[model samples]
Structure formats: structure tokens, C-alpha cells
Target: MAQGNERKSKLLGSGDIVVSFEFFPPKTEKMEETLWSSISRLAPLRPEFVSVTYGAGGSTRERTHATVTRLLRETDLKPAAHLTCVDASKEEVDAVARAYWDAGVRHIVALRGDPAQGAGTKYEPHPGGYTNAADLVAGLKKIANFEISVAGYPETHPESPSVEADIENLKAKVDAGADRIITQFGFDNAHFLRYLERARAAGIWVPISPGIVPIHNFKQVSGFAKRAGATVPSWLARRFEGLEDDPATTHLVAAAAATEQVMDLVDEGIKKFHFYTLNRADLVYAICHLLGLRSARTDASANAA
Candidate 1:
């Protein structure tokens, strides 16, 4: 039960902690290079699994499938394909789930995606689509014994009618066979703690991994957080206020902010972490280093090399 400050010396001293990374499908050639580079850098750490996001309304469907399939074929990392209920009907979504199963991907990040207009917009479920994450999780279970992970909102989803309703929705997802809950990114550790408490009260005993978003582009991230209904503490804003033009300084600051956030969560009894890597590896790698994870071995690092 050592606090983060107390455990600082233990950070990166071992490689036993569990971690997972999130990456979105690349849309361009150059971005693809950057992503593989990041993948190369982080793969040695041997993350529990890496997930590729499905864009709103399945906008990135093809790309997502390609990326995950590539991981299955080329990389040793386990890949989780994100599936969402938004633009597609139940049968269509089922087809995608089956495709992933056929592709040898057993993990799925089941989600009820933001409105096609994006988060903060009014959500209108497609007429014949799975209406929410709960239904989607149930559907995936029917398709396969997929290891399903569903989104949890520590600060509550912007479109949720109330926090109680949000928790109820989360409970439904769990009851429908969600194995893990990865939260929306939040800066305040207290919010995460409270959310976990509430989830426990609601009868969810699954692992609730805190989602950590390193502040690579603070302004852009802050805007996204707001739209996603995640609160950005004023202190976090001040941490990146004047470093807009300084990428080097920004990375250093980003590392510190992320490290501090995770350390605090560790102090609050959270053991697992899910990082939204944003297609960059160094900062997340550093944070994991600070969390006591390391490259698996000479052979693995050589392969990722």
C-alpha cells in the first residue's frame, strides 16, 4: 500500500505490472510510419494487449480491420478490435464481430459510439443497430467468447441523462458479459476513485482500468476532454499553458503530468492502467517505465526492432 511518492524508487525497477495501449487507425502514409515507429518503441514492453479504435459510425472500419489484422499477422502483440453500435445494424455489427473472431482476434472493445456528429451531439441510435454498449456486449458474447471491454465514464458521459443512469448502463454492460471496464480519461484521481466506488455499489466486480491520456497536445486534448465530458482540472491547464510552441518542453511536461496522474491513482489502490497513446510511444513508454514495466527480453526487443 505504498503511496505513489513512496513507490517512486520502485518505478521501472521491475516488469510485472499489466498495461494496455490504445491506437487509432492511421489515415495516411506518413501517419502510418509514425504509428509503426511508436509500436516498435512500445512493443518491447509487452503490453497486455493493444486496441485499435473504430471511428464514429464505423468511419474507420476498413482501416481498423487492416491495422488489427496486421498486428495479428506481423506483430506478437495481442490486438483488440474496437466495435461500436452507431451507423450499422445489428447484423452488420455481428458480421464485423465474426470477422474479428475469424481473424484470430479474441478481444473486443465494445462501445456505443458517439453520435455520428461526434461526442456532445445528440445521440440517436440507428433504427436496427444495437442501442448501447450493453446490447453490443451481449451481441459480441453470442458471436464468440470474446474478452470484451466496455467504456466507463468516471466523470459521466456527456450525453448520459444522469450519473445514476450512467452507472446503471455500465452495470448492464457488465451483466451482459463485459470482462473489463476502461474509463474515459480523467485528470482527477478522486473522480476515478469515486466512480469505482459507485460501480462497486452497483454490483460490478470487474477490473476498472483508469484511462490515462498523456498530454501530448494539451490544447487539442483539453478540447476533446470537454466534449467527452471529462473534466480537465485547472491545475492541469496551468501545466501546459505556455508551452504551445515548445514541443520538447511540452513532452517533458506531458511526462510529468501523466506520471503524477498515474502515481496518484496508484496511491488510491488502482493496479491496472490503460493508456491512450495517441500513436506516440515515448511518453507512454516513460510512464510505464515509471510504473515498473520493462522490455521482456533480448529476443522480444530484437524482434520489435
Candidate 2:
């Protein structure tokens, strides 16, 4: 391994780190207001793109579409609308894809979403829908030249039989025309690096960006990690052990923890990241600034790409 000092010197190498954010479709008017407020603050960062997530079983189809199209119409940010095969037929999914294409939205984060029954349940694709993410990718390609992003699981998807199988699944998606793979949120940098090494060995070279979730609330986030099949190391838990009632301390710790995580990955020569914003902007915005990104409009001519 390279020496820590040696790695630190390259933290901002060439000064370009492609970053993206993920947001869920808001479920209520107040939540919608908060989502737009967060967007207004983060839009200044000029991420490579911001994505709107579809709910499980295509539940947020209309909200996701409206939010995505609104971003396209009202802001300068590129919006990637998520498409999934969960409860829709192939034709219905294709129709949605066509509508996005017509709206001038070109990026899609295609997923084989979770079963509507929720986590730990088996995912059964709609009998007439695309069979999986790979199938969805292939179908989207036929509809239009959309930039497709598919999911990768650093820890191996819970339902997958093995790590090798997960990589093979990801490779299948890439081979089906996915432009990139954005991992499910992960906390351990080693897991991501190992996944990257194996993926490269298998000839899957499309940019595989690690999904980074800033731990604004360790309790809530750890719960998410557990459900998503990610490990929350004891050390991480210890850091937040006694901070549950301390919001100020938690905020500081959260920012520092996420910044350190990104810096570690940057030292490993990783240049791309996708943040699970959870519709909160302050922590994420801070992390981006720490990553050497300034507001693009603030310094467009010299901003990090």
C-alpha cells in the first residue's frame, strides 16, 4: 500500500472529481417544500447530475417524473430519473422511458427495485416486465440513447448467492449498455476498493462510483445500512455511541466522518462519487467543498469538473 503522506499529496490530483446526488421523491407538500429548498442550496455546487429516486414497486412514478422534469425545466442541473422493474409491465415501463426521452431528460438510474412487501422479502419481477436490471438496460437502449446508470452492491446484494455472482450481475448490466454503475451506499472503503479491483479484473470498466451516505443521524443511517446489507463497523458505532441526544456534536462528527471517508477514497485514486443526500444538503454541500468543489457559477472557468 502507498504511504499515507504519499496519498495525501494526490488528494486533489488534477482537481476534477465527478460527483452526483440522489434524492427521493417527496411524499407530502411540506416534504416537497423541503426537497426544493435543499435543491436550491445544492444546485450551486453543480454536481455532474442529480437523480430523483422511484419508490419501491414504482410507487413514486408520477412524483419522480414530476420532480425530475421540474429540475430539468427550472434549474441548470441535469436530472437523472430512476426507472425500475418492480410492479409494471414491460410496455408500461417502456412508455415511461419514452415519456422521459420526450421531456428532454436523458439520464436514468435503472434498478430492479425491492419488492413492495419491503426489505428481506424476495424480489419477484412483474411477470411481463423486463426480467431484471440487465433486461431493463437493454430495453432502455432500444428506446433511446439514454445514459443509463445501474446499481452495484459492494457487500453483495443480500439476495445474491455470492460476491462473484453480484459482480457477474453487474457485468451483465454493463454489457447490456449501462454507462456507469453506482453502488448501494457503503461505509467501508475497503469493501469498495476490493469490489473495484475485482470488477476491473472481470473487464467491467465502466465508471463504478461508490455511493457515499453522509451520516447525519447515525441511528437512522446505521439502521439503513443494516437493512441494505452493509456493515456498520463497531468503531463507527462507537463514534456516535453517546451522541444520540447531541445534535450539534453529531453534526460535527458526521461532517468529519464523511469528509475523512471521501479523502481516504481519493487517496486510493478513486475520482467519482455519488452521494445519497437523503434530501439534506448542509452536510453534503460541506463534503463537496472539502472535496475541492466550489460553486461552479462561483468560479465556472476554474471550478473542478
Candidate 3:
């Protein structure tokens, strides 16, 4: 719709908005350095909290734990650890949740992780384990008063047989005590708006935060989006066309596209956003800058470090 620059100044001039970011655990030492660099850069922005993703079947369990623990001790930002019920038994998952509590983490992004084989593969819950995200939410609640956020698929989850089924699944999660739902990253504003309408119609009132992925690496992001069942607008694909070799142009278009997307959502009365920050801080940092978010050092209590 409207470009970020074309939006009214007042719309772009709000006080620091409530924002959250998602990060994946680093797989290597070098990547670890980059991850922390991103954390340090974005930390000054003062997100509501930053979440570290859990890998499929708890593949990254140890790495995720290490990353989150470091965030607790190294930075001033609050950390939300992602816990998934994939291959683990109910007791195992509960123990992990207890470990998080012991580590001082109170917020959890509870998920029914991807199939161990991978996305698009069949998911079979471990015997005596959570059958799905709703089950996981209920179990986590028993461990502690976790501020749980669950996943929502704007476009039906790829594995879901129908959109109605997907919505029903999300409704169940909310009923199980989910505090909020963060959608998979989507490019089409209408898709998200419609999803919100449907969620409200279903009587699910939790904050369904739209996930924004500033598409810096277009091809890679497009592939991931497809797997996650997020639609890529044709207009968006064209924006990134012919820029495969030009990283600079890709970054520019990505920032503009994401800023415009969030502005449109804001115009539609959405006040909060969750970003999948692929661990490089600049693009997400720039998008937040355009959204009127300033460094916490100058204004808020985020300078706890």
C-alpha cells in the first residue's frame, strides 16, 4: 500500500512501540560472535523481549539454552526461550521448562516444533508427550506462570488440512493459556488483516502479533517463507528481482517493504509487532528506526547494563 515515506508524520512519529525480536541459535563460533553483535546492537533498541528459537525435535536444545543463558547474564534485555515438544517426552519437556525457570527466564514461546524429519514431513508426538502446541502450553503452565506465546499461521500451516483446522488449532492453544500468538512472517497485508479478522471472529482475543521478516536475502527468505506457508506477494518478488547479485539494493528494498508492511498494519490499528531478525541487526534495526523506535539509552530504562 503506502510507502513508509508517504505515511503521515504522526503515524510514523509515535513513541517507541512495543516490539519483540526472534533469533536462531548460532551453530558455530564465528556465528556466535555475529549473533552477540546483533544482540548488542538491537539491545539498545529496547525490545519487549528477544526470543531464541528452538530447533526441530529439540535439535538445538543445548545451543538455545546456552544462548539464552548468555543473554540473561550478558545483556540488559529480557530473554524469552523457545521450547518445543517434538521428540521429547512430557517429563523431559517439563524438566527443560523447569531449567528455564531456574535460569530466571519467565517468558516462553511454546511451540509444537517441526517434525524431526523436517518441515512438510509428518509429525508424530513422542509417547507420553505433548500432542501439539496446545498441549505444550498447558504443560508449561503447570510448571510456572509462564507468559506463553504460541505460533499462528496466517496462511494455513502447510501441514494443516484446511484453514479452519489451523484456526481451530490456534484457538485451542489460547484456551490452554497462551498469552499471545505470533504469526509466521507474511508479505501480504490483506492476508494478515484477514487473518486477524478471522481470529477475532473465532473469539480468540489474545494479541496476535504479526511477524515481519525484513527480506534481506530474497531467495533464501522466499524459500523459507514458502516452507512456512507464508505468501510472498508478486509485487514483493518483483521488488527483489534482478538484485540477486546486489546485496546493497536488496537491503534497501527489504527495509522499505517491511517498513511499509508494518505501517499498513499500524494504520489498521495494530500496535505491536514481532520480527524474525535473522541475526544480522542492521535491516531490522533500520526498520525499527523508521517506525519511531529510538535507542533505549537515550529514553527508556533499557540501559540496565
Candidate 4:
């Protein structure tokens, strides 16, 4: 893979890559400051759109609304709000979608979110609420013309009975009018490629974006991967070995590991990506630069001054 760097460079020079980013709303004032700072740093790269995550059971509904609305009012970037079918009646969920529409947000990431109790717990849909993501997508389409994106799992979802069932579930979402699918974050590129092939064979023709998470903290990411049912390859674990106590060295290794993953995907002719930024920008910004994405705003400023 290291030997393909030159080829990756050549491909990036052709300028067809499209990227988006995902962020979680902040829970406090200090965290809010950090979130905006990260947003400011990344906005110059001009992502296709940036998405704000909805918390479990709609816990962060108000915060998510505030963050997304701020992006609409303050930035040139397009914002996609995540809406879920958990713990709320259909009327209530529809109201939120209406609010987003009135606020000038036209894109949504519709999801059948995790159970409010926790991840491993069984998901019990609210009485009279949309039963699942497919249902939610249908409801949102009825409300307005939203460019909707839904989740995909390269490794089948933990709660799903089988891979076949998971694919069927995805098909249902597409049938209900989802515009695209962004898969769960994964460490192994082979798994993602295989999943894409399976999705295409099943007649899902929409674009499927591979989700990338640059590991800022390997231990924390490992815990998340376990709950999300994504496998962390053993070789990936060894890459961060002995760097647990060294933040500086860990950042370098994290950047390199993520860069390699995206470049390898590029070598496979994947042109679109969605990054789970975890509310920081340095690593993602660095990776975008390595992919030959320079800030158009930066270049304009230099020319003007």
C-alpha cells in the first residue's frame, strides 16, 4: 500500500473527490467553543455537507437544533440534521422535521436510532411513532423533498438477525426513497468493498459513502467499535502499541493510519467519503490536504492580499 502513494497523488490531482463530515453537538459552553473552532477550521475545505448527530432517544434534540441552525445562519456550508425514530410519537418527529424545513435545511440523515436505555438493549419503537428507518424516510418524504441518507453496516448490525436480513432492511429504506447510504465506520477496507458489492448485487443503486474515523484515541475507539459491532483488525491495534502515554506520537500515527486507509480507498476508485470527525479537525484537515484538497478560500485570500 505504501508504494501506491505516487498513484494516489496522481489520482488526487485529477480533482474528483467529494467529502462530507459528521459532528456531535456539544454539551457545554467550553465544548461548544471547541466545536465551532473545529468547524471554522474545516469549513474552508468546502465539504459537500456537514451533518450533526442526534443523541440517543432524542436527548440532544434542542442542542442539535441549535448547532444546525447556527451553521445555517453563520456559515456557507450546507448542514444536514440527523433525525431519529426513537422515543417520540410520529407527530412529534414530524414537527421536528417541519421545523428543520422551515429553517432552510433541506437534507436529513434519517435513522432508527439506538435504544434510549443503551446500545445492547432491545429497541422498542414508540407507540404511534414511525416503526423504523424506512418508515421514517417515507414520513419525511411526505413532509417535503429532502435529500435523505440512511445508515449501512458493512459488518451486519448487532441487532439484525443475519446479514441477509440487514441487506433486506437496507433495501426497504431505499424503496422508501432514501437518496444515499453512509456506512458505519470501519477499519478494514476489504469489508467495505465486499459490502458495496453485496449492496449493488441486491439492486441498491444509490451512492454509498464509506465512513472513516481517524482514531484520536485508540482505546476509546475500540470500545465504540465493540458496541457498534465493527471489527478492529489486530494489525490496527499493533500500530498504536506503546503510544498510549504519548499524545504527540499518537497523533502522528493516527494521521498516517487514516491517510493510508483513505488513499487505499482512492486507489480502488472510491471518490466519495464521510468522516466521523469526533468534533476535531486537525487529522481530517491533514488527510484532506494529502488527498490534494486545498482550501479555495485560502488561495483566494493569498491572491487578494
Candidate 5:
């Protein structure tokens, strides 16, 4: 029998999984309403934690703080606020970290942010800032015993001259007291698997959660992937082709592709996942359901309280 036709054992019944989500701060009142609605919808699945994103050059600092604070005040979800070393002095950055600590925010997703001009532009460390993510991680550790999650690039960061350099940089962050690593989202599972092996070989053993982005919109997401140095595989592109004018069909393909990716990863013994939710719920909720996760009464009860 051809290998393609060979039957394989079932892989979808595994309910043992840990998941987290990432959402950006809202810029307007209507956007804020939409953000909270999505939060309410996904709250029942009980994500391990949900993260709120910071804008470039720390532009959305206040909004990110507001969103995170609301999560702590109103929901049962653990919120991780993103902190970046971008266009701010060490003193300025540390003060923000201290505020998060005082606000009951414990986990931080730290990154050496993109250039102020935006991604694909040159990034120069601020003269008085922590210099880079590794330095920022160590600085954050000193300020508080916060749980720090750092970024990892599976296909190599665009600025890095080679993949080896990126791994070394990841190691520096790990050595600087980062507790976890969440990768840039990518569509290729093989790249992620190989990155896992390389990270293990390099002696960085912290939990590295693979980042999953459900294709809320394929074209927009592909643009994001290009900016963040992640790959948008041609085969994955083909799945979305011709669906541009048909959003309903596009959504169906998106669900199937994301489900297929996670199922394959589960077969490889990966149990932790971090999703770039883009502030949408129905797609992510259904994906979680197909993965055998169900809403817990306690989660919603806490929200009601």
C-alpha cells in the first residue's frame, strides 16, 4: 500500500493540553467592546493565561495596562502583559514593570521590540534602555520575581545573520532568567520541530510554546508573517487561494489547516500552545473544541462574579 493511503491511529482524543492566548490593546471604544466580547467568549475554555500586546515604541503602554488591569479585576483569566525594550530608558521601563507588579500582574512577555519605524527597519538599542531582551529580562528579574516569557524565532529572526546566532540570542534570554519562550507564529510544522531539537541540543530546556495563529484573514496574516520573519508555506497558501471573495469558505479552510497543524504537533508530544488570537473567538473556540477541550462551569462562574 502507498504510504499516503496507510491508516494511522487516532490523534484527536487527547484532552491533555495547556493553552494560552495573545490579544492586542484596543484603540477605540468600539474596539474595546469587541475585545471584551471575544474575551468573554473564550474565557470558558480556561486558557492557561491570556496575553495583551504592547504597541511599537511602547506606544500603547497605557492601553495595555488598562486591558490587563481589567482582566485581573473582572475575570478568572491570568493576564500576561507584553513589555518591550523600545525607545525608553531603563528607569522608564523599570517603572512600568513595577506598576505591573503592584497591579497584581505577574507574567510578562518580554521582547526587544521592532524598530520604531516598524518591522523590517533597523533596530538600534536605546542608549539608556536595557540594551536588548536578554538585558531586559535580567533587569525585570531584579525588579520583581515576575514570571517572564521571551520570544523565540524558529526560522531565525530577520536581523540575525544566521539561525545559529538566533539560537544563541535565545539562550542569552533563557540564561537571563526568562521562564518560558513563545515562538513567532509559523505555518510550517517541520521548522518548529527542528527548532525544538536544536534548542534542546543547545541546552535551553525551558518550555517553548509553539505560537499558533488561526487564519482570521489569510492575506493580512501572510503580511504579518513576512514582517516577523516567519514562513508562509506555499502549500498553506494554496489552501487559501481562490477563497478571497468567499469568506465563509476561507474560514472553513482556515479551521481545517489549523486543526491539522495542532493534531500533528500533538502526535509529536507537544502539549503546550500559545495562540495569537487577534481578538476573535468563534474560530479559536471551535478549534479548541475539536481538540477535546470543553468549557468549565467554574470559569464562567468566576466571570459572572
Candidate 6:
């Protein structure tokens, strides 16, 4: 076990923490406006890279492509496009990977997405599709030398029969050429630490970036957690207690909660994070600022002068 003072010193010391944000492609014009507004607000922060999420079973395939291509053309930010092997055949999936490569997107978040039937349902791979994430990773590698990031589950994946099995699956993805692991959002810092230890013990050496979702709406996030198999601890529930009637207070509480969570991870020696931004930037921006991230626009303006 690490000494308490050692952990504290590590947290207090300077480290270059890399951050990335995830946004889903919008489904409608109003939502598209909101999504771009949020993207513009966060683009100035100079995140390591921003990712656009693909919907289940390639539901948002076209929209996700449009969003990613726009980011490529208009922004100074690096974009990571998400690709999943849920409903598409191997040929179709490979075509998409080739398209992204030709479009100059060099990073991908590879996932074995949830069933099109919805959460908690059994996943049936398409007869001609890549069977799982590892297979998809290998397929993408064949198409291009893309940097691939695969999902990790601190709380075992719902379909995983055991934690040991889940680790093995993660190892398979790594072996298949994944570049990094971006975990599913987790509330408890201890869970992430333990998961990291387990991954190391299993001989997986890729950088595992902890996913952080600042709780803008407790009820909504709780539902998401339930579906994703992340545990919302009692302590976390208590923190949001009685704030339902006040949006202002909820936002403040959410920022503080998320900031503290990240700080604790920093104390434990983590230096990278992936934020699930949910198409809203205020809370994520505030938390990033608290973590000492400054807008690159400031430097750009000074340089221009």
C-alpha cells in the first residue's frame, strides 16, 4: 500500500494532465445548435483531443460522420471518431474505417456497442460482422494505422461473467492493437485505482484514462449509471439530496463533486482524463478550469498582439 503522505505529495506535485472530451452527434437542428455551441465553448481549452460518439448499432452513422468531418475542417482540435461493431458487417465497418482514415482522422474509440434493442438486452453479432471489440480493433488496424482507444469497465461489464473474464477481454483488445483504455464513467476513485492495479497485474500496459461525467442531472445520470453497470454509491446519492428543486445549487454541487473526484485520482497518480460532456459545457469547463486548464485563446490573442 502507498503511504498517505506519498499520495498527498504526488497530488500536490506538478504533472502534465491530459484531458479529452466526448460529445454525441446531435439528432435535430436545435440539438445541433446546442452541440456546436458547447463545442465552441470547449474548443478553446485545448483538450488533447475531442471525440464524437457513435450511436448504438450505427444509428447515428451519418450524423457522426458529418460531425467528425466538420471538426476536422473547421477546428484546431484533434478529433477522435468512435466506431462500433454492433450492427454493421465487416465490409461495412471496414469501409467506415477507411473513410475516417482518408478524412485525416487518426484516432478512433472502438467499442462493442450496446444492443440496438437497448440496454440489458442480449447482443447478437451480425452474421458477417466483426464478432467483438478485439475483432473490430484488428479489422481497423488492417484498414489503417489508426490510434485506437477501447472501453474499460471498472465495475465489470454487465455481460461479463466475472471480473477476471472482463480483464481477459480487455487484454484481448490490447493484444489486438488498442492504443489506450478510456474507462466507463465511475464515481468512486477507489474503484478506478483497483481497476488499474488489476489491469497492470494482467499485463496490460496501455494508458487507462479515467472517464469523468460531471453530474448535471442526478436522476438522469443515475439512470445512465444503472444501465452502464456503474455503481452510484450511497455517499454520492446523499450529496445530491435535496438539490433537485434548485438548478443553480445543483450545478455548483456537481462541479464541486466532480472536481473533488478528479483531485482524488490525481492524488493517486492519474494524469489523464476523458470527460463525457453530454453536449453541455458549463460544468465541464468549470471543472477543467479548477484543474488548472486554461483557454488557448488567451495565448493566441496575446500572440496576435
Q: What is the lDDT of residue 196 in candidate 2?
A: 94
Candidates' C-alpha lDDT: 0.90, 0.91, 0.89, 0.93, 0.90, 0.91
* TM agreement with the true structure for every prediction: 0.94, 0.95, 0.94, 0.96, 0.93, 0.94
On TM-score, who's better, 1 or 2? 2
User: What is the Cα-based lDDT of residue 246 in candidate 3?
Assistant: 100
Global local distance difference test of model 5: 0.90
lDDT of 4 at 295: 89
**lDDT tens per residue, model 3, 1-305:** 44556644336653636899999999999999999999988998889899999998899999999999999998888999999999999999999999999999999999998988886578998988999999999999988999999999888888889989989999999999999999998998888888999999999999999999989899999999888888787888999999999999999999999988887787777878999999989999998888888886756454553
**Candidate 5 ranges beyond 4 A from true positions:** 1-15, 298-305
Q: Give the per-residue lDDT of model 6 (tens digit) for 1-305.
A: 34666654244421356799999999999999999999999998889899999988999999999999999999888999999999889999999999999999999999999888887689999999999999999999988899999999999898999999999999999999999999999999888999999999999999999999999999999999998899999999998999888889889999999998987787777889999999999999988887767778776787899
On lDDT, the stronger of 3 and 6 is: 6
lDDT of 1 by residue, 26-86 (tens): 9999999999999889998888899999999899999999999999999999999999999
lDDT of 4 by residue, 1-305 (tens): 43544565456742578899999999999999999999999998889999999999999999999999999999999999999999999999999999999999999999999888985589999999999999999999999999999999999988999989999999999999999999999999999999999999999999999999999999999899999999999999999999899888888999999998988898777889999999989999999988888887877887899
Clashing pairs in 3: none
Cα shift from native, residue 1, model 2 (Å): 5.3
RMSD of each: 2.7, 2.4, 2.9, 1.6, 3.5, 2.3
Better of 1 and 6 by lDDT: 6
Off by over 4 Å in 4: 1-9, 301-305
The TM-score between candidate 4 and the true structure equals: 0.96
| TM-score for candidate 5 | 0.93
Worst window of 10 by summed lDDT in candidate 4: 1-10
- Give the best candidate by TM-score: 4
Best candidate according to lDDT? 4
Candidate 2 segments whose C-alpha is farther than 4 A from its true place = 1-5, 8-15, 300-305
